[model samples]
Target: MTPEELTRPWPPPTPKPAERGAPPTPVPSAVPRRRLLRWAAVGAILVLLVWSVQGTGVSVGALIDGREGGLHLVRGFLHPDLSAAFLADVGSAVLQTVQISLTGLLLAAPLGLAGALLIAGNVGAPGWLRGSARAGAAFLRGVPDLLWALLFVATIGPGPAAGALAIAVHGAGLLAKLGAEQLEAIDPAPVEAVRLTGTGRAATAVLAIIPQARAGLASLLLYQWECNLRTSTVIGFVGAGGIGQELAISLRLFRYDELSTLILAVLAMILLVDQLSRVIRRRMGAAT
Candidate 1:
């Protein structure tokens, strides 16, 4: 290279295709396409939201008009019925709700564990078995607890038994699905190490997989129990028997004060269950 050319610039710019007498490269449209796609997605989401609002009949004016009635209800809730007779009934209903939730969870735990074992990938279950288990769990979960309660109510007559059975079935499905995911997500090293010992499948799973997944499984079960408790109260509204039945009665009679008391009782029960679950989970974690 000439010294003059080297002194002109340390690095010279390449000539453009147009200057080289070649057809100018077409500017890529990718950026514009991407921008269009993003705008399209935003528009689609906005359309969906508007459609949902219209279909659901959401109205700011209706909410404003109901302010007085809402205040009346709030006042009733503030001054909840605390009469001795009513309190006694509330206590009984609360006990029944607790019993129903306990019964449901007890019945669900074993069934859920079995289903979890079948569906869990690390367990080496056959594909067909896993698929079948998944299908069964889906069926159980697809039917709402309220519908299950109605079915049981029709078959066994309305009572806490129906509610318990409903909760059991639904809780089993929930636990099975969650437990399977938990099992799948556990540390694979322990499982692999156990298998290397030439242990049988069941032995390896019990020793390695179960131990690793125990805390998660326990947490899932406890959470399901809390869910069952809520479901128990709801099922009672269908005459399946629990605090929900009392709630239904109060609503039918327009006894807002009693309804408020029942609501408070439900809230207290939920808070108690939540706290108990947290403590149990903490202890389990510590023990592990």
Candidate 2:
């Protein structure tokens, strides 16, 4: 290489683009907004907590202060009266509870399905029919089962029948609302296609909508069964008839041990039903 060639600006010394220090990091899309949102949420929760504490006038700490009493109450479970006669009575009451629950569900299922058909917009029912269905559901749901039980108790007298009727009406309303919602959310393509074939409304619903929502509706029915079971025990106090009446008697007498046994039985039943529901859902899911 010649000295002159070396001295010549070699490929014209490309002036290192005047070092503009470090390149600025671009801000993320919503970092500040997210941070602001996070703080806002935290503040809202703290405010709610404070409001609850002030409004309720019940300090959360006080709940723990009764640890000794709580333990004493819980320990009463140990002395549950297991006499044959007591158990027999309990069994009878339990049967009553089951009878009310199952009977009510039976009555509710069909009524709810009918109401759902009327309520479901996809069913293409007349506007007046839909409105009537909505009104009926609202009426049923708005009135608690206890109130219904009272009405039945007055009209037909107190028994499992009254309880069944009460729960059935309430369950019908709930099922109707839920079923309608489920039908509403279903894909319209199949229904439209069925309609295109000159199918009747009933045929279209059975083929398209009902099939799509059958599984979901069945699950809802099962859940309602569980709810009705629990509720029957409660309505028993109102003389709708069940072990709840026995429970009230026991409570009146302050038979804590008996109460413990009854409570445990109820708890066991609920847990068993819950487990069964989970199993059913799992099996259904697998089958589907």
Candidate 3:
């Protein structure tokens, strides 16, 4: 606090330069390359989509031009051949189709459930066993349903029997795969509790696992039913015996009226099935 210290340029004053005006604000450099890349990527995707549509002959303009033809066709279907004779044939064909679907679904359900259990690792199998089951299911799924029907036809001769068997085989594999996955994703707590209760494997699976997975099981069955219905149509094409056979014959004979009627009938059947399935599923979900 001496007077001299205070007065002696504060002992040793530091020279400070005045603040140079604020350093120039940063200006981002333009990235032409990045912008170009973004635009190029968008352009490339557009080009690819356009080329795909063009290659497939999917011309929107042409579709628009043919809209009237489509309308006429639809009108023809609305006034389908409802003659008594044709009606009899339609009734018979429809009965065959339904029979095939129901029978196939029945056959597929248990088999599919078993396959799913094995493949989805719900069953206490070794990894290799599970893998093999899964692989087999995948193989079945990979083959076209028509191919399966053809194989059955070639081997066993053409008929509803061939159709049913083909559908059954494929349906089993599909349902099994789905069921197995549903089993895999279930609440393990119940399964563990079942085990802890000294329950056998079969009891544990049936009571603890199956109940929990019932919704998925039902859904899979219903889905397979839908698929089987479509499949039955295809089998008819190969003489596996269904409305499809009649359809093929009608087409070959240029029986446009009959063909239209048949198509309408098939469409009605599909729509009815779809509605019924939806209702059933809704009821199930609600009950659960």
Candidate 4:
């Protein structure tokens, strides 16, 4: 080799094809197709949003025109009734609501856990049994808690019992579905190892599966309790008995101040439950 060639860089940069007087490589068709699909999806979403807004009669102008009425409502909410007698009644109703939620959760927990065990794929339950349990859970979930409350009220007469039963029936379905998913997501290795130790099917599940999934199951139950508490309040509107009944009465009598008090109570209950659930979940995660 020549002296200049030997002194040159070991790895030299190559010139571009265009610089070499050659045509650029053609772009792939798939790239343009993907971009087209993305734009189409965005356009479809925009169209659906516009259609929904028009169908729902959403109007900023109407909202602006009703400002006075809105302000009046706001003022009433800001000035909740705090009389001693009313406060006593409110406290009682709140307690009843709590009772209903607890009763429902107690009834639902075992039923839900059993259903979850049956439906979980890794549990080795009979296929038919799993399918049946899943179907039953679906049916329960399909029927709203309000409808359940209505049914119980018609059959057993209106009271806290009806509300509790409604919450239980609906919550069982939710818990079963959620718990099954959690169980299915657990580490299969532990389950397999437990089985190899001559443990029976049920024993294996008890020893291996449940322990791993317990944290998730506990969190689900807490969430369900929060939901049950909210549902108990609403079921009272149908005469099932709770703070919701009082809310309905207040609204019918144009007792906006009382209504405001009930709303605040509900909000406070929700916040308390949320905080408690958060703390429990944090502690569980730390323990795990």
Model 2 TM = 0.77
Summed backbone clashes in each candidate are 0, 0, 2, 0
lDDT tens digits, residue span 113-216, model 4: 99999999999999999999999999998999999999999999999999999999998898889999999999999999998888988998899999999999
TM-scores, one per candidate = 0.91, 0.77, 0.79, 0.85
Error of 2 at 181 (Å): 1.4
Instruction: Name the weakest run of 10 consecutive residues (lDDT summed) in model 1.
Output: 4-13
For model 4 the local lDDT of residue 67 reads 99
Tens digit of per-residue lDDT, candidate 2, span 20-115 = 555667767898899999999999999999999899878767779978767766677778989899888888888889899999999999999999
Better of 1 and 3 by TM-score: 1
Better candidate number, 2 or 4, judged by lDDT: 4
lDDT of every model, 2 decimals: 0.92, 0.89, 0.85, 0.93
Candidate that would win on lDDT: 4
Write down the worst ten-residue block by lDDT for model 3: 13-22
Please list the residue runs of candidate 1 whose C-alpha ends up more than 4 Å from where it truly belongs after superposition. Answer: 1-16
User: Model 4 — which ten-residue stretch has the worst lDDT?
Assistant: 24-33
Residues 1-288, candidate 3: write the lDDT tens digits.
888777787457554443554566677767987898999999999999999988999877998999997886667666778899998999899989989988988888888888887776555767887888889888877787789899999999988988998899888888877788888888999899888889876788888888898898888789889989999998899988889988989878766778899998899999999999999999999999
Query: How do the residues 242-261 of candidate 1 rate in per-residue lDDT, one tens digit apiece?
Result: 99999999989878899999
Q: Which stretches of candidate 4 lie over 4 Å from their true place?
A: 1-28, 286-288
In model 2, which range of ten residues has the least summed lDDT? 14-23
Clashes of 4: 0
